[model samples]
Every structure is written in structure tokens, then in C-alpha cells.
Target: MHPQRECDIQAAPTHLITLGAEVAATLSKDGSLSEVLQICSEIIAHYLKTTNVCIWTFDQKSNTLTRVAFGGKDIYTASLPKTIFCQEDYLENLKARLLPCNFRNTPFSSRLYTLVVENNLVGAIILFGKEYFTEIEDIVLGWIANNIGLAMERFLAREKQQNRGETLLLKLASKLRHCLDFNSILEIAVKEVRDLLQIDRCHFLWYFPYCQNPRITITHEAQDSNLSSLLGDFSAERINTLFDKIRNLEIIRIDAVRESSLDLETQEMSIDLGITSLLLIPLKTHSGQFGAIACSHCNGSRYWSDSEVELLQAVCDQVALAIDQSEFYAQTRASALAAQAQAQQLTQALHKLQHTQSQLVQQEKMSSLGQMVAGIAHEINNPVNFINGNLIHAKEYIEDLLELLHLYQEHYPNPARQIQDKIEDIDLEFLLEDLPKLLSSMRIGADRIRLIVLSLRNFSRLDEAEMKPVDIHEGIDNTLMILESRLKGSGKNRSIKVIKDYGNLPKIECYAGQLNQVFMNVLANAIDALSEAEEKFQIQNMQIHIVTKMLDSDSLIIRIKDNGAGMTEEVKKRLFDPFFTTKPVGKGTGLGLSISYKIVVEKHGGTIECLSEPGKGSEFIIQIPVRAIASFN
Candidate 1:
């Protein structure tokens, strides 16, 4: 013992004994290491009249001494090292001594008492502003340091146990950080937590907070052998009660259901599930709660440590983050698919609109042409009829006059010298012979004009309203007559010969004007094709075969084929697509064939298709129902 402690023990032995008893009693309590140290510090300071006191713990791993508690004056400790390296000679020598010297250069006197337990350096206590110490005071402090060392040993052992759980939590968090799948995250979390804690069962319940009444679903579970599953055991009413607590971000820990403050219903339900103790950690972030993780012990009533609760809560946090990430990924993928579908629909709509616009323009042009042709046919038909009627009357009057002249010639053969002079001057014999031939030529010309006017009226059936039964052959013939000028080549080229294969067909019910327009379009295209072929190939034979036949009782077919410069497969594919033309710009409007298709297919509820190959003839096949069944305006 130090000389000063010996003097102190003799001067105040009872007070010294009392201080030792109080310090021993404080360290013996089942409180935290810091709490006990703080109480011991106060007791020592009060009895000794010390100005400053601090307790430091020793870390053998790092060879450092760290101040764990300070119970007195703060100004003295402000300049002192909160942590001191044990590698220093002064601190290294502390492990072998009961009373170490105060080596720090301070304004006041200082003392250091090294604490040892079971032949190991656990911690120490330092006192400042104490100029001298009696023998009894030194002895009491020695007893207090010993008690503090023993208390630190117990606390360190408990801390080592906590570190084990913390290490496992860190490892589970590392695995979770690498995983982004929601279900996989839940599976890994529950299994690792149950295994680490050695619990009876562990499960994850999933729910969405945004719903009116969110359902808590058991998504994943891990358990020991012979344990009953809690899957599908939570009813909606039970979930509501359970979720109310979870949503508050509370960690509900029931060490023993019968002893805990939980309601009877929860206690009974827990017992039914073989759960004597339960720990539930809510999975949440700053946004909102996602779900909860339930850990249960079924063997008997078990106590849940703080370290265990902390480990499970940390794992649940990682699970919530992974779930949020997966939900975002799924939403992004769905949005991309929806956008692609919408883009395709828009492209199709635009194509349809273009076709409709082209068809409307073509229909307008055809309507104007039909009106003009009907007017011309009307104006010319009357004059031609008048000329035709007067020719017959004039022929009869000239023949009667010629017979009278002949009778006069017989009655007065030598009577009038003036008449004889007129006959000699006018060449009477030639005049009588040519007069009848002139009348015959005039009558033939008038008949040709009448036939042309009739063909025009037939081609432009503008006066007819609604669908009616009309001669299909007559429509074809009228279209042919209208295209006669094109069929005849302009210069040295020969006329395009048309071969008609008329079939025995009944009168079909159809729109007269529209059907006539279809025939006109087909014949016009045939003439144009033959003209192009004549210009390019220059082969002598140019023929268009117009064939009509009764395909069945309800339908009829018309085929107009031409020996022309037939189109390639590429052009044929878009042959009836509006505004898709092989002809050069300004020469062709590109709507002729498309409008013809609409009139045949849409207007008449019929079918029209083209078949052709390069250098071969092109054929347009139209199949119309014999009796038009489609109602129209």
C-alpha cells in the first residue's frame, strides 16, 4: 500500500469502510456498465472531496484506453486525451500496477488507479485536484477500481454476444443489396433471420398502404421442423387489428403472451399459432409502411433481446427497398409496351385516312364528268332525231317529183325551147342519177350519229336513281363505244381490237350509274395499257378481251384483259392502293383504279382483283352479285 493510503486508513477507517461498501453495492446492481460507473464515480467524489473523476475502458485488440464515463469536473478532462494508446510506455506499464502515476502535466495534482480483474487489465479510474490521500481513502479507491473491473468484464461479454447478431445482420444486408427481385428478397430475408435467431418460425406479410382495405398476404416463410404454417391463417378482421399496430411503426414484442400487456384476442391467437413469444418488425421507409416481419418462438416462453430485434428490423428495411425497385421496373416495362401499341394504331389510322381522301376526290371528278356527258347527250339527241325524221320525208318528195318530170318528158318531148336550153346547161341526165345516192349517204350518216348519242346516254345513266335491274352487256357495250377514239391509234398504229365473250346472263340488279362508271374505268385502263404496249413493244397485235359470264345463280363475273406492258409484282401489290401509281406525275392521277375498286367492292358489295406479269397481258376480274343485296343512298 502507498504511504498516503496508510495514513488515510488510520485517520478515518470507518468513512473509508463506508465508501468501499457503497462502491461495492453500486457495482453489484444489474444495471448497464456506464450507469454503475457513474454511480461509483459520484460516491467516490463525495467521500474523497475530489474535484474531477473519469473512468476509462481498455481495448486489448487495439491496445488503447477509452474514457467511458466522466462524473465530475469537465475543464480538467478537456485537455486530457479521451483515448490513450497502450503502446506508450506509461500506459503499457499500467497493466502490471494497482496504482499508476498521473503522467499528464496538469495545473492540479492527479492520481490514476489501474483496474484489473482475473489477472487482466479491464479498465482504470483517474482523479484530479487531489494533492494528497490518506491510507484509508487509497484502500477504498483500490476496492472500487476492482469492483469496476469486474463489472466491465460482464458488460463486455454481453457486448460480444450482441456483435454476433450484428455481424449476421451485416452479411444479410450485403446479400439483399445485390438482389432486386421482390419475392426473392422476402425469401432470403425471412430465412436468414429465422436461422440467425434460432426461432420457431419467421414469415413476411405483404400489403399496400394505398388501398381502401389492404390485404396482408403471407408471401414467404421459414421455420424449424414439425412446425405448423401460419399461411392463410390471418383473416381480414385479424389483419386490420394487426396492421393498425404495424402502421404506427411500432415493434411489437411479446416475450410471453400470458404475461404481456397485449389484448386477450392477440394473446389467444398467438397461442393458437403455437407462438409463446413474438417479435414483429414493420417494414417501412420515409414514404410509408409496406408490411411486417413476424418472428415466433413456439417451444416455450422466450425472451427477445434488443440485438435480435435490431437484426430483424435491419433486414426488413432492405426488403422494403427491393420491393419498391421491382415495382418501378414493372411499371416502366408496361408503359413502354403500351406506347408501342398506341404508335402502331396511329400509323394504321393515318393510312386509312389517306385512302379515304383520295377516294372522295375521285368520286367528285366522276360525278362532274357524268353530269356533263348526260347534258351533251341530251342536247345532241333531239337534233339528230329531227334530221333523221326529215330525211325520210324529203326522200319520198324527191322520188314523186322525179316521176312527174319523167311523165312531162314523155308528154311534151319537143314543146319548150327554154326547157331544152336549161337541160343542156345543167347536165340533166347526171343530176338525176346522183340525187338518190346523195340522199342515201345523208341517211346513213344520220343513223351513225343517233347510235353514238344512244351509246353516250347509256354510258352516263345520271337520270337513274337507286339500284335497278339493267343489262350488264349494254353497259359494257356503251363503255366500249365511249372509248372508241382511244381504241383507234392516233397515227400509224393500228386500232386496238376488242374481243367480246358475252355470256348468257339475266338482267342484274345494280346501281346503273356507278356500275357504268366501273366499266368505263376498266375499259379506259385497258386502252391505256394497250397504247403503252403499242408505243414500247411496237408488236402488231393489240387486243382487249371483254368476257362476261354467270359465275353462279347469285353472282356474275366480268374479265377485261389487255395485251399491254404489264406491271411488275411490286406495282401490282399496290395496284388498288390510293395514290400509288407507276405512271409519271401529271400524266396519271393514280386514283382511277382505286376508285374503281371502292365502287365495285364497297358500293356494290362485289370483288375486283388484278392478275398480271411482266411482258404478259394484264387482266382485271370483277365479280358482282346478280341481285344487289347492299342497301345504299
Candidate 2:
């Protein structure tokens, strides 16, 4: 039978068995790239019966080769050319196929190589010895080559990520030492590092102080248009619950987002914003935090490394140092304020004070903004640190499974009965499919946390220009969100229905923040009225109708109407009067409507009035010039 047909010679079982036994140990996912590559060289040398086995990597910047690893070396050579691997003929050979070539200048010895890392043909094995192989031997060499390729793909990706993170930290630490401007610290740091990392976006989110929870707002953001903009103050409900990891200087990394511990709403919101994965590293000390440095991946998932985590922690240490240097004298600011106040001479101060007062007002607003941001940073730091700590273990687990699965296919093409049983027990196919979903979840979770911080940042934008075109609807939306819980339900268990009839209107020249406050006052009052009516009338359909439309060519109108007991003529007449309120004793400050009226009328060159009858609901009508120019200064 053999004489008749014996051409189907397969690779020996010993070749497969030897590779199977060593592959897992040599190319373990947890092994460092250098360590694995070195082991790979040693294994190949042992099998090929050559002591002159070496791995040489190419340097693209310079036409050079760098020896990464050598096996059973006893040959001393100071005459080796650095650019041997980068030569045109050498590259052509590598691209063509695995082939032998003359070694050095001697035809007596020979060399052959196979591609290792694919990134710019990063490296390859150089078998520097006279060798002739049978076809089966060549097949074994091919197997090792393919294995090297797979190992390089994973190891190099991780290595690249780790190196980038290290470079970022080192540069940031160095820059912090030389940075002189304390006021613009957040802005400068984020911009510099974001550019250096070549990431889609970066931000330093600060926590709001007045809120009881870890409510956050973004104070500084450096971003590209690759992702949806996250720039606004978000409600506390949206904040991520993983700041503890960040507090411990752990870095949170999300490689590929699919499913996560975050709520569905939050995940959806992140997807809406076009963020896929991100890294949140806390800039915190034992005492407190400066904020977190968020490196976002908008386009796809990216592997994060332990080296990257440590590097970020070091960077955070430097950030905290800078913050300490910058904010260490915060207590002395009060004394400085008192000194400035005493310097104000009455008559001289009046004119100078008017201009200075406007300046001071803006300064105070910024100061408040700064305080809120600082708190947010401190709050979000811990959770991000916590997430960072956990992510390492999670990644290792996933990598272990993937490595095991890969080895099963590569080494043991025909798995034993016990191995097959285990695979079936584990439902290997389903596990493979589901493993990636976990990463997707983590990515979604990280993105959700980022979105909250972004929103808060957007809400805190302080325009230097006194009169600029701004979205009034955005301001209203933010205000309504702040009071969302109150409107969602009342003491009587009745939900308030808010009907918004917004019309297409051009962005009006206005103070965006001030307008937001106006919306807050009006919306708050409407909610209060609805709550009262819900209790008094036991009404299930409490409603607040908000309408915004173009009043004329150059003006816009806003109307807030409540379905509650209406105000009488006397109440309506005194609604805009200072210190006037129909609310029961302690509940009524009465200045809310009065201040709101002044904002719409005197400040923005607008008109405001209450239109109501005693038994009917009340409607507050406001009209503002769309393009009116007013100098706050």
C-alpha cells in the first residue's frame, strides 16, 4: 500500500506536541513582549540546532537594526552593521518569503529571517548559521513564524500604549515644574497632554461643592471633533460611582465598550456622544484631589497597561504638587479682598468702582465657577481610581481566556477527550462570543462617566464677551434638568407634566449664564405652584407649559404658564415689586420674580408681565430683543 501511494506525509506529532507544551508558557499574555520574544529565540534555536539565533528589530527613523534578543551566544562581533535589516535587498527578501542568504561577507555561513512584528516590519528572527532544511523542517519553521506574528500583534499593541503613557507622564511632570501661571493651570495641562498623547479628547472635570453628592462639571476640556461634544453641567444622578479607584491612583481603562455596570440610560447617552472607550486617571493626593485627567478613545477600543497606570499616577502626583503650589494661599485671598475693599475711596471709587465692580462681578462668577469645578474634580477622582484598580484584573482574566483558546487551536488541532470535555463544559464558542461583550460593557461604563463630566463642563462655560450670540434653549434645558426631580413628582404623588413648544429662533445676543438663572427662577416657581395645586386639588394632571417663539423679526418671546390657582389683579400688579410675595410667611422670599423681571427688562432691554385672572392659571410673558447689544461693563 505504501509503495502504491505514500505522498500524504503530515508534520510529525512530536513537532506539534513540543510546540503545544511550550507555547502557553512562552507566549503567555501576561509575559512582557521582550521576555516572550527572548524565549521565542531560545526555543527556535533549540529546535533548529543553531546557537547563532537572534532577533533583530528595524528602526524606521534611522536605517538601522537593533538586536532585541540572542540565543546561546558565544560569538563576539563588533563588526556587525547596524542597518543590515533596513537594506533594500534585505527588505525584499523578507517580503518575498523565508529564504537563506550569505552571512556577513562569507558564503560559507548563511542567514534567514521571518517577520515578527508587523508594525513597520518592526523585527524578525535572524538565523545566522549555515543551515539546509527538508520540507518538513521548513513547515515547523513556518509554524514558529506564525506564532511570533500573533504574539507580536498583542505584545506590541500593549507596549505602544504603555510607552505613550510613560512619555505623557514624564513630559507633564517636567512641564509642571516650569509652569508659572496658576490661574490657567487646568487649561494648559489638558491642552499640552491631550496633544502629546494624540488622543481624541482630554478633560479636567471639577466637582460641584454645594451639592451633597458627587456632582461634577467640566472646568477644562481639550477635544477633537471626532466625538460628540460633552460640555455642560450634569445632574448628580449621571455621575459615575467608581471614583474610589482614582483616589487610590488607579487608572480606569475601557478597551471596547459593549456592556457595563452603568445604567442603560447612561450607556445610551455615551453611545449618543460617540465615545467608545476612555481612561480616567485621578490627580489626587492623600489629602484631596486636583481633578482627573481623562484620555478618551472616540473611534475604537485601545488596550491600557499597568505601566500606563503607574505613569498616570506619577503624573497625578505632579499635578497635585502644582495645585498645592497654586491654591496653597487660598486662605490669604480673603485678606487680599479686604485690602482691595479698603483701598476703594468713596467718590473716586464710584466711577472706578463701577468699572471695577463689573470686573469684580465677573471675577466672582469665575471664582464660584472655580470652586465648583475643584470640588467636582476631587469627587470624581476616587471612583475613577477605583475603576482603574479593578480594570487590571478584569483585563488579565479576559486575556487568559483568549490565550487559552488560541493555544487550543494553534498547538492542539485535535484536542484530547478531557480538553474537549472542558471546552464543551465551558461552552467555548459562546464564551468567545461573550468575552468581547464584557469589554464593550466596560467601555460603555467609562464613557457614561465621561459624559456626565462633559455636560457639567459645558454648563460652566464663561464667555468673556459681554454680548455674544448664544443658544437660549440650551440654557433653559439646563435649568429644567437641575429641577428635574421636583418636576418628576410631588408630595401628593402627582407628576408635573412639562409641555415645551419651542420654535426655531436664531441664537440671540445674551448673557447665557444669567439667562439660565432666569429660567431657573421661573421654572422653580411653576413647579412650586403645580405641587401646591396637586396637594390642594388632588390633581393628577398638574402641568407647566413653556413656549418660546419669535415675537417679531428682531425679538423673541418666552411664556411660562402654570395650571394652578391664578393670581388676582393686585397680586399681578405687585409681582415685579421687590419684597412682594403671596407665599405663606417663611416660604416666601418674594425676590425671585422681581429679580427675574429686572434681568429680562433692564439688563437685556426686554419686557416682562404677568397675564392672569383670579380663578384661572397664571402665565408669565417675557420678550427680549434678539440682537440687542448691551455692555455689562
Candidate 3:
């Protein structure tokens, strides 16, 4: 027998020391309150030689005792009272210092009785053995009561601690949900797990698909820098190899580790970092994928509790939710930014389109003015030319008439009328000479006035208002006539020649006034180009060529080619651009070609292009569609 058992047997006859020791050892080994009570009943029945042994736990709220664990030889077990005695019944006995054995008169048969301390009357142990109980047996029952009470206390403490941990985890989850930033939430989760579970090192590894590796992003690391270094280089593969056995399992706990259990690499790493034991938990989210959290102890191996695993799993859930939210916010912000940029680009394009439209309208107006000027100038030139020529002839005739008058006056110097009676017969010569002189001078003045009136009427083409089908050649002819005076001015003496290769063509539908303006602009530009040409040799062959042709479609093609100082590619490129001119300041508003371009192209759907090269002459081709454009109603 065990020494403690023999000492109990020597003390009392009824006591069974062996049964008491057996019960205590059973409770200690099992570490469970319910199992401890069952062992207590079995020990009393077999060793105390009792017919019945029943254990009842107290319900403090109901002030009653109820059978909780019992074992007995049948004496009609159904008739047994579930409640032995209430707290009120025990109150008087307890105050009078009467032993619980005094309650034997009631339905209960047990002799020895004890209270289970779970808030007042937690439970009781009733031992009914053979009569004439020995002192040793009484002592053994006392030991059983003490051991049961201690076991119940331990169970209650453990339960309370578990409930507290669960509550803490719930609070942490609530806080994590409120956070929008993934990193912030992760950091908090790591720290809370470490603090709550009292772990030495805690690290969260984020799985990166692109790299095929796990990144230790957030950590509540220990003080050892070497340990951190060891963990930093640890890869997902190595971790998998170490924990391969438990990879697919749930809640794996390694209570202890031997040096031989660690692979060579892990062992070496642990030596450097002074790590003794490690706990690796696969963090699973609601979707059922695995991330990992690694905790290590530098001092010694750790036995991780069930509560610790539960807490970590709770944190992992929160982290997954937070990360999802963060990604959603990022995508939403990016979409909004892209939409805003597109809107801005559209607005800018609209503004540019409006500006171009405005420029087109202004150019159209300038083209119209150029046409009217060309027409009026052409009409005025014909009369001006006639008047100018006649003026010179009239001057000559006047001089002759004046000379004849002077001669007649000298011949009949005095008293021609008195002597006229006698000399009347000779007056015929004087009358003839004087009358011829007077008639000659009057004819010269009348011719000059007629010329002025004719020039004035032809200068204004008031007859054509709206557009009409007209011969383009006639318009060119009229333009040249009007500009004749300017063309024949001192500028012409510089040897500028105009060549015309006008093709025979039928009259076509066109804005006659506008076409005339086109011709004037081309001619004027040619003249300007000729003037700007450097006087290299004798300025002889400065020529402007104008060609006109009728196309198969009844459209007209007018081309003006100049052999002055021809334009370079740069000049030709911008020739039709509005507000671009090479003419001297104030001499050109830069609208001539621009206006013509718009009128022919935009209004009539014609095409214009310049063909020119450096040192080579430039040709501007204008192809106007003969068909009138339909009006937009």
C-alpha cells in the first residue's frame, strides 16, 4: 500500500485510506469535475463497503441540492430523492454546529455528508457504508470531500478565463471592421494577438501571387535583431516543408520540440535567433484559403492553448475583410479619376472646334470684299484708260488751236469791222481760220468730260448683285481692266510680264463677284511676287501664267502659275492659312488666299492646293464644282 494509505488505515476502523487515495489520484489525473465525482462514488461503494453512495451538487439560485453523480447497489434507485435538503433546512443545523449526519432521519440514507462549494452549497458527498463505521473510514471520507471541492474550483476558473478571451476577441473584431486601411488593421491585429495570448513574437504573412511567396508585412516582433533576420529570409516553401504533416489539418499544436525535429536550415536559423519553439497557424478567411501567422519563443518551448488558436483565427478573419474593403476603395477612386480626365479632354476639343469655326466665318467675309473690289476696279480701268489717252491728244489739239488764234489776231490787229465793209471780201480767210480754232478747242474739252463720266460708270459693277453663272474669263478681263492703271504704273517698268493661257470654256454656275475676287487675288499676288524677286540679271522674264480649263464633269479648273521668286515649301504650306502673309506690313491683311480658300472649298466644295519648290515657280490650282450647292433650310 502507499504510505499515505497505511497512515489512514491505522487511524480509524471504518476508514478505507486506499479508496480515498484512489479517488484523489483519479480526480487529479482526469482534471475534470464530473469524472472526479464519478470516481468518488465508485470508491465509496467498493472500499467503504457501502450499499449506496450519491453525490448531489447544490443549485444556489434554487436553494436546493440535486443528485449529480451516483453509484449504488439497487435499493430502488428511482425512489431516491433528487433534492436531499435545502439551504433553509441546513441553516438551523449549520448554526447549531450539528453535523450533516444529523439529517439521516429524512429520506436521505447516507451518514457522512459534505458541501460542494460552488457559490454556497455547490454539491454534497453522501457515503453509506456498513454500520459501525471506523475512525479511519471517517477520515478517508473527509479527504474525498476536500479533493472534490478543489477540482470544482479549478474547472470554474478555467471556464471564466475562456469566456473572457472570447469577449475580448469580439471587441477586437468590431474595432477592425471600422478601419478602412488594410495596413492599419493588420498592425492592430498582430499587436492584439501577441498581447492577448502573451506570445513572444507574432508575424503576419501576406500571400503574393505574382512573386509566389509570402511576405511578412506586419509584425509584433521580439527584441532580438538576429531573430528578425532569421525570419526575414524564411520563405513559404521552407515553412511548408516544416509543417507539411499538419498542412491540411485544423488547430495543430506542437507542445514540445527536440533539436532533431528541426531541419538543418531551421535549426541553424533558430540557433542564431535563440528561438526554442514555434507555433505556425494557417489563417483562414471565410472563403477558405490559407495565410499564415508565425509565433516564436526565444526563451523556451511553449505549449499553445486552445484559447490562443481561437484568438488568432478571429484576427485573421478581420484582416481579410479589411483588405477586401481597401481594394474596393482604390478601384473606385481610379475609375472616378479616369472619368474626370475624359471629360476635360472633351471640353478642350469643343473649344478648339468653336475657334476654328469663327476663323472660317471671318475669312468668308474678306473673300467677298476682294471680289467686289476686283469687279469695280476692272470697270473703272477701261474709262480711265480712254480718258487718259484722249487727254494727251486734246492737249496737243489745244496747242494748235491757240497758235492759229494768235496768228489771226496778229493779222487783223485793229478795226477789222470798219474796214470790214471794204475788206469784207477778204474776211473769208480770217473767218475760216478763227472758226476752225474755236471749234477745235471746244471739241477737246467736251471729249475730256465724256471720258470722265464713262470711267465712273464702268468702275462700279452695280448690275450684278446675287451670284450667277458667268464666264470666268470675262471676270478676269474686267479685273485686269480695272487694275490697268496700277499695272501700268512705275511698278510695271520693272519688267513684270503676265502670261495668260486661258482655255476656252463654257459659262459655268458660280458666284460671279466671288470668282472675280479670286482672279484679282491671284493676279495681285503674282505682281507682288514679281516685285519681291531679286534683280539678279536684267529683270526680263518675270511672268504670271493663268490657265483655265473645263473638266469632263462640267466643273472649271483655274490655275495660276508664277515664275517670280517662287515660294519654298514652308511658305506654300501656310499660304492658305488665315492671317498669314509675306506681304509688307499694312500692304496685306493676309486674308486674300485664306478668304478664297474658304469660299471655294467650304462654300462651293472646291479643292485648292499649292505646288511649289525652292527657286521653282508656284502653281495654285482651284477646282470649283459647277453645280450649285443646295441651301440648308
Candidate 1 Cα deviation (angstroms), residue 101: 52
**Lowest lDDT 10-mer window, candidate 3?**
94-103
Point out where model 3 deviates above 4 Å: 6-136, 139-143, 207-252, 284-290, 314-318, 328-633
> What is the lDDT of every predicted structure here?
0.79, 0.67, 0.64
| Candidate with best lDDT | 1
* lDDT tens digits by residue: candidate 3, 1-633: 358765865674433556766776777674456666776787778776666777766666677666767766755356556665564557446322222334344454345456545345556666554465655666566656766766666665566556667766776677766777756766676666666666667776543323556533333343334444333444545445444433453444544445446566656655565666666666544445445666767776687776667766666666677666666776787898898999898888875564475456654664454455556556666675676577568767866876886786788677567665755776755865676576566566556545444433333334555556777787777677656655564843554556788887877766666666677787788777766663543345677788888776658898888876677778888898767898789999777787777667876777888888767767889998776766600
Question: For residues 404-520, what per-residue lDDT tens digits would candidate 1 score against the true structure?
Answer: 999998997885888899998999899899999999999999998888888887777777867889999998888888788878877877899999999999998888878888888
Total backbone clashes of model 1?
Answer: 9
**Cα-based RMSD of the predictions, in order?**
11.4, 47.2, 21.6
Candidate 2, run of 10 with poorest lDDT? 1-10
Tens-digit per-residue lDDT, 515-576, candidate 2: 66578778888787777776777656788999999988989999999988777888788887
List the candidate numbers ranked by TM-score, top first.
Answer: 1, 2, 3
lDDT of 1: 0.79
